[model samples]
Target: MGEKSEIRMTNDKKRIVIIGGGFAGVQCAGTLSRGLARDQAEVVLFNDENHLVFSPLLAEVVGSSLSPLDVVVPLRQLLPDVLCRTETVRTIDLAASEIEYESDDGEIQRLGYHHLVIACGSVTNLNVVPGMADHAFPLKTVGDAVALRSHIMAQMERAEVCPHPERRRWLLTFIVVGGGFSGAEAAGEINDLVRSSARYFKNFHREDVRVTLIHSREQILPEISPDLRDFAGKKMEKAGVSLVLNARVASATPEGVGLQGGQFIHGGTIVCTVGSAPSPVVGRLAAPTEKGRLLTEPDMRLRDSKNVWAIGDCALIVNAHDGQPSPTTGQFAERQGTQCAQNIIRVLQGQATRPFSFSKLGELCSIGGHSAVADLFGFHLSGFFAWFVWRGVYLFKLPSWAHRFQVGFDWAWLLLFPRDLAHVRARPTDRVSHAHYQPGDFIIRQNDPPLNFYVIEQGEVEVVRSSPRDQNGEVIAVLGPGSFFGEKALLSNEPRVASVRARTPVEVLVMGKNVFTQISSTLTPLRDALAQALNRRRVDVWKDEPQAYELLKRTPLKELMEPVPQPLLKPTAALAEVGHAFVEHGNEFFYVSSDGQTLDGVVTITDLLRARAAGAAAQTPTNQFMTANPVALAADDDCAVASNVIRECRLKALPVVERKDTRKLVGCIRVRRLLAYVFKHAVIGAPDSCQARNQLAGGAGRGMDWNNPAS
Candidate 1:
């Protein structure tokens, strides 16, 4: 309340706060400044950067056709009447009509406002496809453009120095994911730049360079008309850009991108122009959201909030003309900004605010080699004429006369001279990242150099080793969630001994060898956990007990498991009936089923005791006390696998099913029976082993027939 009072003051002036400095925020401030006098309101715009980026022309920056500074206008220069503050906003307190931000002086401050405009745009997120965040380049900001430009040039340099032909081709290849305006333009520009600059490098040839664009739709530029899309696609292909339509990226890695149907496109560089997520500030808002954008009223006001408005990429505003949500584009953002400002002024003057309504002006996309496509009003344009029109339209769209002139000059210079090839040589920093693999995808192959240590986050993977008996390779172990691998080779500084392949779609958090070593050496808890897992998973742990290992490996689970107890209880049976059955059969657990054969659930003695102690009625159904879909073994599984599963799960007994896909109950194997059978059959040379078998066998030695192990 005190903060509100201070912000309002005693004067008649009102304070309007704008949270972004993009096109929407700039347009809103411009409109508000003209509509209201100095005494009526004070307009303040907050942006982390002091400049507004002309995003549509960002591809030109990557192509080296436009100077980086030419596409950006200083906010202070653009909005002379509005107060522009370059500070990071920490949070927006909607209820208090205040915003908390960190000032340039490193102190937290809160400012109250009569009206707040949310224009903070969306951010690039590549996590939709696994390993994309780690391996793909994103083109969203000016910095991203610069970084990508540098990387492109760096790849060219590497390709020149490489002696191997295939390696050189890999270095020269570039893959762009997405078919939207950004993707099309970026791919075009990149192809043009690399092909044109090939002559500058001694060993570089235009034929060796490959630029591929992958899209999940049938055509490129789905926003434009079908004819225009076809024209653009054909024109780009003629200009040497390969189009991969109706293909979706399943995963991305340093090697390349893997498509959904197991096709891998090999390339050294991957540029992702898809996947946008809400900005942190916008995500923290309490308002309703669609997809990731805040849902606003037709007049651009935030739903349920009187003085708060939202526009641009962060907002989902329905258009009055089409009765459809407005597309997230610069033109729509500008229109929303202007309409929102007028509405705010109307609210201040006690007048009715009008709904936002506007028809789209046009769309222009520039492909490489002086070609473009345009959809203006109802007319379609393409080729060199469209390219010229595209340049002319964006030239005047520049906020400042100086920027327009600078960009115009750059375009003219590009037509007469070659594209720039020089780039910064700063080394990229390395960090831990995440990756995804599809079923049968080899995460690591045997004898391959260890580069990354992996921790399974989702799905399962199998440790496989090549054996003389099986040419396809024998599966040693199946690891699920919370299990980790690839550390043994990394820690020992040796090549991998066994290959790991995804048993299902898998996600893993990957750490580089250097990072894994540093953390494993310093973190005590992680070190101890890794050591314990290593001891349990060691491949040759039974080397000393050869005979015992041979017996466990050669025997099948069906031979070692006893028959399932007779008269399985129905799920409708009473808890009292289950207790009585357990006592009568002298079994520790009973299987529950609806039919006579199919297993539904298992009820242990512990479960019965728990249900009784919880004051459950004796008439309570057995299903209520049963553990459904319990861990089970397949009838064809070897005794060794069952032994490992039992030891890992710390279970006294495990149920055997007909197969993994079918739930038909076959039999059960007890730990005591398994250990006793192994000891009695295998010859024990060690004296301690004989004593251990005598203690384990106990009363079983009197009545049990050693010849029938499953009895």
Candidate 2:
């Protein structure tokens, strides 16, 4: 009998989990798989969809120049050696180092991991204009492109046969909201399709069909120079697509769009191609955001949570050169993904991880046919030169040689064949109601066979463990929105640890076992993150201090109230001066603190109104009615505390003061100012706040807030 030599196991083998199959995720997985040796690591791609969508060519797909399948490569063939699974990851357990997902078969599963990579891309940002979700078409997913194509073809056909001229106009009119690269490209492509297709339809008048591009800004493709944007605008206008500038779509209906200028353009189909942000998952993480984008550190790591890393559209990684996060373009996203992969490897290998750096190599947009606009390495070109460069760059970036070959072949074949119009219907999984769930519903019964891990969508649920002496358990923990349950069972393939019942009508997603396992196996830190989240819920003592106002050092000034537009006085002694200031100047108040450093209380014209109402003299010190306390806060105090103090005292115009020696006021934040700040600046500025700085300073804390809309 001979003993077999012991097999050697090294740290070379690593498991990486990727959540999306978009350009970023696909590129990361493809690069990692091919770059590493067989024994080095394992790359597992977990996606809700089975194919990788070539996002840059999506407009072509919609234009009938290319088919949807032509742009989508099957994940299995794209990365042959890497593991590919179609599952919806529902929860990330960071503390326990695992992830949970719902498989197509409706079973919950979990996967443990050694490393994690989040390449989840952005989704279309709807819910902006009224009736947009119900009526507008978005061009993000493959299905969306196909549906828009079908709708366009069908509308052309319908317009030709219609007897009424108004109906025909409505049917032929196409309005695209936004003038960004996507919008301009989509408008141009659709215009080209209509120009070509109308030749075949007899009853439709090509002139009757109107194509309009509406933008809220003065220029399109802000990524390019103003001169280039003007050039693009001129090209679009020459092609018969009207450019509506400095106007936004206020609302959308099946019939048309209502512009901010009150101009109504009737249309059969409306397309929105505005840029997007991180997935809704970012919101749940409770971190700062920049315009709905998750803020990341210079190293492309999330602000607070370490051990966690986010890339692509999900992260607002600052550009070292411009002090701005890289744009959400396919090129930047792919670069970020690759950089993220490199960082991941370095982190796992105990090597120094490098921060993300951005270089503006190029920007391109296809106008129509072979005509395009491009800016490469500070070199700008148009027409054939730009188009050819666009093709070459994208071809080189394709995930695999097989995919590149397929795409190239398709491009060549398309010249000889008309585009195929076959529709592929991928049924949606209905494991959970996105909108509603009632109380007493057993989300997952204890002792029952565990199927799917539940991702809370809305409302609340209760995780109850039977008391040691009782046969049935009473309510124990109330899980609110964004909290997940059934994670243990999903990750370990083990029996249910507790009974989860809905405390209110709750909405949740059920993730199957295989998918959960796949996600867990790839994103190791997620397992620990999720467990820490649960533990945080369990140990939270905030509930005990419901009425307690915790003093925060960085109070958000935007959360405080601002004064309405009242007239400003010239600091005169006359009552007429103050009254005239309120009505004539319309400044709303005196700018007592124009300088950034030495600001005091502002005397608004509205104070006159209150004084008159109380039958008090306007000259009565002008300080008595100043509301002495005025809810003061330090300039560096937590912004959160400002809002709490305002709410608690029911006051407006909180003073942001310096507490060191002078205790002098710096600025007065009015309720209105606060509200506007929250509505506007919070979407952009908070991503660069102290909270983000503190979190990114150090620690394996979770990355960006997975649930914040700003993220």
Best by lDDT: 1
Winning candidate number (TM-score) = 1
> Which residue pairs in candidate 1 collide?
none
lDDT of 1 at 420: 83
Candidate 2 stretches with Cα past 4 Å from truth are: 1-13, 35-40, 275-277, 286-288, 409-711
Could you tell me the TM-score of candidate 1? 0.69
Please write out the lDDT profile of model 1 over residues 1-711, one tens digit for every residue.
122222444347899999999989999999999999989999999999999999999898888888789888999899999999998677899998899887666667788888999999999999998879977999999999888999999899989988778869999999999999999999999999999999999887999999999999999999999999999999999989999999999998767899999899999899999999999998887889999999988888899989999999999999999999999999999999999999999998999999889899989999888999999988899999999999999998999899888889889988899988888776445468777776666788777788888988876676677644654675555565667888878877888877888765678898888888889999999899777665455434344455664577688888889988777889999998988898899988888779878878888899999999998899999899887655567688777666655554445778887865466899998877878777678544463654433322322122111111110
In angstroms, the error of model 2 at 96 is 1.9
Task: Give the TM-scores of the predictions, in the order they appear.
Answer: 0.69, 0.57
Residue-wise lDDT of candidate 2 within 95-202, one digit each (tens)? Answer: 654667765566666776666666677777767776566568998988888889888887887787887687688889999988888788899889988876776778
Per-residue error for 599 in candidate 2, Å, reads 47
